[model samples]
Every structure is written in C-alpha cells, then in structure tokens.
Target: MQATKKATINIALVGNPNSGKSSLFNALTGLNQKVSNFPGVTVDKKTGAASISPTLQANIIDLPGTYSLYPKSADEFVTYDVLVNPSGDEQPDMVLIIADASNLKRNLLFCSQIMDLKIPVIIGLTMMDIARKKGVEIDEAGLERELGVPIVTINPRKNKGVSELKKMIDLVAKEKQSVAPRDFIDSAALAPEVVRDIRQYVQVKSDYAALHVAVNHGELPFLNGGQKLAITNLLQANQFNKTKVQAEEIMQRYGRIKHIMKNTVVEADPLQKQLQTEKLDNILLHRFWGYVILLSIMFVMFQSIFWLASFPMDWIEAGFGALSGWLTNILPANQLTDILVNGVIAGLGGIAVFVPQIMILFAFITVLEDTGYMARISFLTDRLMRQVGLNGKSVMPLISGVACAVPAIMATRNIENRKERLITILITPLMSCSARLPIYTVMIALVIPNKLIFGFFNLQGLVMMGLYLLGFVMALLIAALLKLFISIKEKSYFIMELPVYRAPRWANVGTTMVQKAKIFITDAGKVIMIISIILWFLASFGPKDRMEKVTAHYEQLKTAHPEQSEALDMELQSEKLSNSYAGVLGHAIEPVIRPLGYDWKIGIAVITSFAAREVFVGTMATLYSVGESPEDNDATLREKMRNATWRDGSPVYTLASGVSLMLFYAFAMQCMSTLAIVKRETKSWKLPAIQFAYMTVLAYISAFIAFELLK
Candidate 1:
C-alpha cells in the first residue's frame, strides 16, 4: 500500500510579552521560518514550518505578543483578528498558548479567555526551572483537566519537551481541532441581550466569538458594510456598554483562573524570601549604580566594536583595494571597465569594508536583548526620558534607533500618548543609526588620532560613543522643545514587565549578526551601486565644449612636460572631473555649504547620501577612485582623501572640515526611508515635511558652529 499524504496543520503561538512564545517558535521551526507583515499592516508576522509526526506537517505562525483579546496597539489588533476571525488562508487550526509557569495566574488569565473562544488550544508551559527556583510548582495533569486542554512543560532553549508539545498538537489536530467542552466563563450571563442579539444576526463559531464581534464589530475587517450596520444598530438598541461588558468578562475569567490555580498549583509562602530576580533587581535597578552600570555597559559595547572589528576591517579594506587594482589591469580600458572597476566595485567595496563593524555592533545589541537587560535600560532611562515628555516605552524605540530608525519609529506604535509618539517619531532619526556608522568611522579615523584614553579606553571608540550620546542628548533636547510647542494634556504611564535575566543564547546572537550584516549589504548595497554608476557618469563626462577644453589643456601640458606624463595625466583627469556635470552640481551647492567648511566634492557626497547615509562612504570611494593618480593607484580611500587639496594646494580635509562634515551628517534628516516610515506611521506628509525641515536646519547650524569654533 502507498504511504498516506501528510496532513497540514496551522498552529498559532500566542502569549503575553516575554512569556517564551518566541523561544518555543524557534525551537519548533528552527531554520524553516520567514518573517513578513500581517495583511494590510506593518506589524510583523513570523511564520514557520514544522513536522509533527510521520504523517503530520505543521505551519506555525508566531503571532504578535499581547496581554489580552482586548486590543490597544496595532500589534494586539493583529493577534486578536487572527484568533477570532481566522480566514481560509490563515487557518490557525490550533492555538498554542505559551504560558510562563512562574507567572501562572496572569498567563492563565489570557489562556482562559482564548479557551472561552471555543478554539482548540494546548498550553505549552515554560520557565519551569525559574518557577522551581521560586518554590512554585504545579500538578500538570490536574491543571490540564481543569482547563480542558492538554498541557506540556517545556524549556525550548534546551530543546526540552518539544516532542511532547508536537505530539499534543498532532493529537489536537487529529481530533478535528476539538473546541473546549465548556467555556471558561459563560459569556451570555454577563450581557444576555447583547450576546443574544449578536448571535442572532452575526454568523460566528460560538457565543464567545459572537460577543467579541459584537463588541468590536466596527473594527473587524471581515464584517461587511451591511453586517457592520446591522451590528451597530443592535448595539445601539441594546445600549450595550462595551467597556462595562469587557470588564465583567475579565473579572469572571480571572475568578475562575484563580480557582483553578488554587486547586492545581502549590506556592511557597510569600514570606519565604524574595526570588532571585528580586535579589538581582536590587543591585541592577539601584538608582545611582544603575545609571553608572548602564553607561559602563554602553562604553564597553562601543569599545569592543572597535577592538574586535579592527583586524577584520583592515583585511577587508586591503582586499578591496587590491581587487580594484587587479581588475583595472586585467580589463580593457573603456567606459565599461572604468565603470566596473571605479564605480560599481569601488562602491560595493566601500560598504562591504564595514561589515565587520556592523556585525560586531549588532551582535552586542542582540546579546543585550537576549539576556533581558534591554528592558532594564528602559527602566534606567525612564526618568530622563520623561523630562522630555517621553517615558520608558519611548526609550526602547530611541535606543532601537541605534540599529535603524525605520523599525524604531514603527516601535513607537506602542507609545499611547499622541504627543509623545509624534515627538519620538520626529527625533528618532537623530539617534545615529547604524547606517551612519560608515560615515562616523571614516570621519573619526581621518580627524581623530588612534590613541588610548587612560591606557584603558580606546580614544576612537570613545569618540564613536560620544557621537551616539550626542545624538541621544540632542533627541531629548529637541523632544523637550517640541513638548513645549505641541501642548496636548494627556496622561501617560510606563508599565514594563522586566523578565528575569538569562544567559545569552549564542546561536541566536550569531543568527542576528549574520542577518543584520546581510540586510546591510543587500539593502544598502543596491542603492550605493546605482548612485555610484550615476555619479560616475556625472563625474566622468561633462558638456562637450567644456570637456574638450579640459582635455586639450591637459594634452598641451603633457606635451610640454613629456617626462612628467603620469603626473600630468593625473592632473588632467582631476581637471576633467571638475568640469563634469557632477562637479557643476556640487559647485551649485558649494556656496551654501561653504560656511560649514565643505567644498564642492564633499558637497556632492552630502547631496547623494540623502538617499541613505552609508552611501556617503561609497560616494567617496567612487569619487576618489575615478580621480586617482597613476602613482597613487594602490592607495586606500583614507590615503586619497588625506592627499586631496584645494585649488590653492591647501589640504581639503582638516580637523575643522572633517568635524564639520561629521556634525552635518550627525544631525541631518538625510534618509528618505526614515521619512517614508514617519509618514506611514503618522499617516500624514505634513509631519514628515516638518521633520525634514527642522533636521536639515539643525544639521546646517551645528556644522557651521563646529567649523567656526574648531577653525
């Protein structure tokens, strides 16, 4: 007989924030996962594949973490929509509730509510070790009988109990995704009229699901215009108090969960001594010490990025220079060869050279997050943030801005206050995103000496840290200023659940490092290469008459000094580039940027890098390579920039000019991607317009002041 075809099952992993949902998903899916957005929203949807048994294959969707079915943020809304009204395509056949065994009550409250929805659910209890350390224990079978669903204790990090969980999932799916035998709490008893009315008109799976639709029918995407109108009229006729009904439902669910916990769980006395988490919190959360430690950690992170990445960076830089030289020799001398060697290769090499530094930075970030110290960072910075009209919640997004502002701005969706969210979005771009890493690295190397501070700290690393701090400090100041102008009185509170710190997952850290480096290379690489080619075209050719004159002058000079052929050739190429279209465009903006100590070449870079900040380095590489002297053919980008001079033969990049340029990039709203995200989040171009204007103005002023003072 032929083997049977595998049955496909879709499982939705749901839980409150920090309840081990992601850990379980990672364990189940391993490398068989992909990330995307939920339909019509920016909230991330993580879906993966897993094999449950010989004949069972599963599609696992890791839903956004949320507290309850009642939705507040877009993240919660997506999860709620998926669970209550799963369409044909999104067949969440079984909902796996990832409940923290230690925090059973709260997790159970959320679980029970989902159970009441009459969907198939299996509880994957996690953090058992922590719960045991805290002297908390539960009778698994008893709890399972009480909730009318299978329960499996797991520690996904160790690959424990995952097979059992899969077996349970397969059993549930085989039973036709059996709904709970009884509701966790009767929905009709709380609001008989509303629930009955909804059930009569709305086609739903159960009374509880009908209640959910009735309460939030207006927001449900599946409801048609006629259905919504009908439900709205029924709600009005019944005078259904939505908030009142929701509160009652929550109260009843919790009351039953409390009883179930009392029957099945055993806990040590409250006075038995504080848990380990509490013990650590006392030190890590200390007011003065906490700030000191936070800064120290940040200092170490920045310093390590430089210390660890320097060797690899040097190797990459040397390799690219050698490759460019080799390709130039092998390829025929033509526009195509010139473009390939001097334009595309140079641009790619510029960005690729920084991958080591990028990976190092992301690795550090990933460790902080994996170990749960990232949450404490918010707690430590909350007071300081609130002084600028933000709270601990805003701190996450701003700090996240260090990685990239696009997701950081998207992160502001959790900030409840309108004014605070707007301020966060407006200032997030100033947080010195990793895209600015290339610019900062090159500028600091050019201007700041490579030395050690106090024989312990790297001076270059200290300056990089200072640049980040400068961006953060400026964000706070700007936020405070905006707070004064945009007056809307709204109360905001920061409620964060700081999970117990655990050892860093090295595998996850490595995965994050690789992923971040890949995104940087792929996303930023395409832009840099295109701009480089265009720039090469602009810098390679000029108006017919102007180009002929430059070539003629150079040829005459070469003829006069036959022995200085190579030197004259270099000078000729430089002269031709100055007369090229790119040079003309740069000169147009030269006067405006002159006060900031920038010349036409630097002006061109600043203009092009507005598409993406990392492109600044790529632009430099292409420009300098195209204008290279025959004698300086193998010289690196830094050497080329160091040798650059003005018409008067004075060096172009001095302390004043390099610092000015750095400051300009540091403050500028130079990323179109960030602006687009701001518009999407704010739902208006007006705010993005204002954001662009203010940041550009700030960049100019800061650059101007630094140049004059340093000069």
Candidate 2:
C-alpha cells in the first residue's frame, strides 16, 4: 500500500473591520471554510483551506480585525494572543497582514505592531482604488523598506493581485525569499532611566531589552511576564513614575510614525479628501435631511423586497408544487407516498419559498454597508438610542433585526458597552423580522381590505409599514423599562468611525446572499422537514372508526349520485377529519381559544406554530390540503377558509380571527432556535425563560384585545 503525502501551512489574515478583510477571506476560501468555536471560547473561529497550487495548500485562519494587538474586548484579545504566541498547534508559517491603503496611517500601526512577531510577513494592501481616489499615494518600496514585508496591492473584490499574493506566500513560506527586519521603534532608548528604575524594584534578565520587546510586539502586562512583575513592584514602590513612563512610550511611537510619513509618503492634496467627504456628508449626515434620506432609503428597501421578489417567490412555490405532484404520481399509494408528498417536500418547500425575500434583504443590507451608509445610521440614531439606554452603535443591530434576528444578534458584538449591549440584545427580537413578514402578509391579505389611500399609495403597504413602526416603538419602551431595573453604569459612550463613502461591492453582496441562503436551506430546512413529517402522520391516519366512516360515506355518495360523488367524497373526508385523533387534539384546546374566534383546526396550527412562527403557514397549507383535497390556489384556500363554520354556524376564518392571529404571531416567542441562541449567547437560561414568559403573556393580551375589538 502506498501512503499519500500531506502538506500543511498556517496563515492568519489580520486587518481593520471594514478593510475588505472578510471579502478577501471569502474569495480565497470560496466554499471550503467552516465557522466553529475556538476550544472553549464562544468567539467565532473561522478556518478555511486554500490550495494555491496543486502542490501547495495553506490552512488559513481569519482572525478578528483589530487596530492593535493590545487586548481589549474578548474578540480583540483573541487576536492579540493568537498572533503573539502562535500556539504550537497554530504556529503559522506565514502572516498575511492586510491593510486598507486608503487608511494607511491607522492601518500601518497594526502592520508595524505585527512585524515585531518575527514571522514571515506579507502585506495585502487592499482598497488601492479608494486610496487613489482620495489622492493618497503610497510608495510600495518605501513601505516595504519601513515595515520589512512583501507588499502586494490587492483589490479583493476584483480578484486583482490575489494570485501574486498567494505565490508570495508560498515563496516566503518555503524560505526562498527573505524579508529584512524593519527599524522598529525602541521604547527603551526613549526612556532609559524609567527602564532602569522599573527593574530596580522588579525582576527581569535585562530591563531595557524586555521593555523594548514588549512595546515593539504590542504586548500588555498579561503577556509580558517580567514586565507584569515589574509593574506590580513599581506600583508597590512609588507608581507615579511608572504611569509617566507608559504615556511617554505611546507619545514616542506616534512621533516616530509622523516623522516617517513626512519623509517617505506623498499626499496629492490633504484638503481635497476632507472637502469631498464633508460635502457629501453635509446632506447625508445633516440633522434634518439626514433623517429624511434615511427614512426614504428604508421605505424603498421594504417596498422593493415585496415588489422585486414577487416573481422569484412565485417561481419557487410553483416549482415545488410541480415537483411534489410528480412525486405523488410516480409513487405507489402507500404511507411512504403520503410522507414524500405531504411531509418532506411540503416542509422543505415552505422554507424554499422565502429564499428570494431573504436574498433581497441581505442584498440591501450589503449595499448599505458597502456605501458606508450604515455607519451614518449609527451617528443619526445615537442621541435617541442613548435615551433608551443604548449607544449609537446599537442602531445597527436594531435595524438589522428587521431582516433576521440571528445576524442582528451577531452585530451586537460591535457594541463596546456591556450594559447597552445587553439592553440591545434584550429588545432586538421586538423588531419585526423577515420571518414574521410572511405570516403578516398572508393574514393581512386575508383580513385587511385592499383599498387605495391618497389616490395611489397602498393601504396594505402602509399597514405593513405601521407594524414595523409599532415594533420599533415597543422596542424602545421595553429597552427603557429594562434599563431602569437592570441597572449597570454605562461606562463607554459611542464613538463611531465613519469611513469615506464608496460604491457598493456587488461581489460582496452576492457572497452574503449565498451564505445566508445556505444557512436557511440547510440548518432551518432540517427542522422544518422533521416537523412536516410528524404533522403529516398525525393528519393522515386517524382512529379506525373515523376512517371507516369517511370511506363508507364516500362509497355511498358515489353509488347514489355518481356525477357529484367526487365532490361529496372530498367534503365527507374533510368532515370526518373533524373527528380524527388530530382533530380531537385540536378540539380539546378549542374552548380555551374559542373566545379569540379560532376553531379546532386553527387551534392546532396556533399550537404547532409556537415552535416556529413561519411554520404556521405550512401547517395550514398541509391541513387544508388534506381536508379539502382541492386544487391549490390562493382563491380556493380563501374560499374554503371563508366557508368553514363551527357548530354555532359562524364562519371560522373571519376578519376578526385573522387579525387576532396576526397580533399573536407578532408578539410570540415562536422560534425555538432563537431562544436557544439567546440562552447560549447570554450564558443563562434565566434570561431566555424570562423572555419567553414575558413575550407569551404580551402576545395573549394583544391577541385577546384585537379579537374583541375587531369582532
């Protein structure tokens, strides 16, 4: 037997948050990456494999973007530790230091810090086009001379210079090309007496050398063992001089950087860049027009989701129906056939139908982020958000919740204030998510009248918009209420760094859409499939006597009036369904909900839907299809629903019932996955349980009032 040789290399991509770091990672790795936890930490660890050539493959780790390796938040701390120590398990052969060419001054601080690690470093100079547009010119050779790294100008979105970047990585990894060490700033040289004094009270092999290494590598007290001991001893001995020494070092580093830029860098015109950004931001970040423009953008985004995605949604629905019909035709008449058509296919179909909506939502968000408008939104909402016990940055997550709660929750990681972040997370679910939109749309179409308002504007669209506004109001109120009780001093105020405006990156937009769609299809699809199958079995076979009665009724009707027999069979089958086991389950709970205007079947849907709100539509579609056995049509479903009557001879799905149902879904904690995620993120069952209880109580109260008033 011949053994296959395996090759491995470790590499890290380090850069600022918006410097096209993630875009580059996606392009290099393509679909060959996995996001998982790093050992015991909850921070996401993104790892991927990229084969630069047939003979060479590199294991890439996308580290969290940070300005310096000095640990702060948990996310940034990970990057600091990982790069400095380069664990025996992750001893990287090469480090790709990504920097935004446009923001060279700030980006180079991190680049210079990483060079002290003594690893084979390569520079991925991204956003070169933006840099050129801003009249900033960088001498690549000068940067290489100063930083001692191979610099490659890359446009990741366009895939420019990527191949060269990879080739450089291989050569550096193989030791074919050597990078000279830069003239790193020496902190010891700047403060020789302070270093001598620090060591007198503390212990280190060489005080000056250790302090120089610590500052060069951006090591804090925790990482520098001897420096930490010296700090403690110095604090015990008089600490006033130690504070002066630390501040002096920071000032010296900036001084050296300014001197280097003056000699080696060239600026086309410094005033021009500022003037351009200021002129655009005048209208965009204005006190009044800024808010107006933001609202208009939001309005267009929501309307486009509904109008633009209508065709694709229809195509998805029809395609699934045709496929399911074909499967039913080919399969033998048995339990397996029923499961295939009604269970697996139907469940998957329900989620598949919403793909277009999800894609559109993601696309809009991507464009906002790419054009740098999202940062402005934070600035615009900061004052108001502060009133509700949140930072300006909290606006990003709240707005994101309009699309989906999962990513919105992830966005909260950017909020530096712990108290404000907790408040934001606690209230984010109140924002009307895209998942809620489907349920809202179906109910609104069924209950609300389609009337023209003010000549052309749609009343239905306005109501949809109103629901969103109501959610926002509730979010603010709830956040304020929580802040009053869960008191924690807000330590940090919001400081947003707004990047210069630019055109949207369509490649990034498409990449994000694909990633979200995959999660929807795979993760959400599995749960829906299992639920669909279970519901199918429950509705398909009933009690023996009930099944016999249904068959006998159909037979008798067919013999007596053959011409009308088929319709009679379907009606009798539907009637017998009322006495089946599933029907008994629904009926058992109907009295409790009867005051809210729902019958037994809707009762079952309401119950099952508590597992996930979107499942409500699929549940009804399956239940009604099984009951009526009629052609699938929105009109047919509506007519069947309209004619459905209870023992009291009143219609079941009236406007009042639909309105109550809509209100219930709007406030319910109907997603188990969200609850689980909340528990995981907050690190407690206490918060999740409290959230579920409060939301459920609020839902019931709201639903009851809607039913009573509407009826």
lDDT of 2 at 137: 80
Off by over 4 Å in 1: 1-3, 86-91, 330-332, 487-489
For candidate 1, give the lDDT: 0.88
Tell me the tens digit of each residue's lDDT in model 1 across 34-62: 98878778777899999999999999999
Q: Provide the overall lDDT of each model, using Cα atoms, as 2-decimal numbers.
A: 0.88, 0.73
Q: Once superposed on the true structure, which residue ranges of model 2 sit more than 4 Å away at CA?
A: 1-7, 53-55, 86-88, 176-183, 187-246, 268-270, 273-277, 314-337, 344-351, 511-515, 543-571, 630-643
* lDDT measured at residue 248 in model 1 versus the true structure, 0 to 100: 92
Taking all chains together, each candidate's TM-score versus the true structure is 0.96, 0.86
Clashing pairs in 2: none
Clashing pairs in 1: none
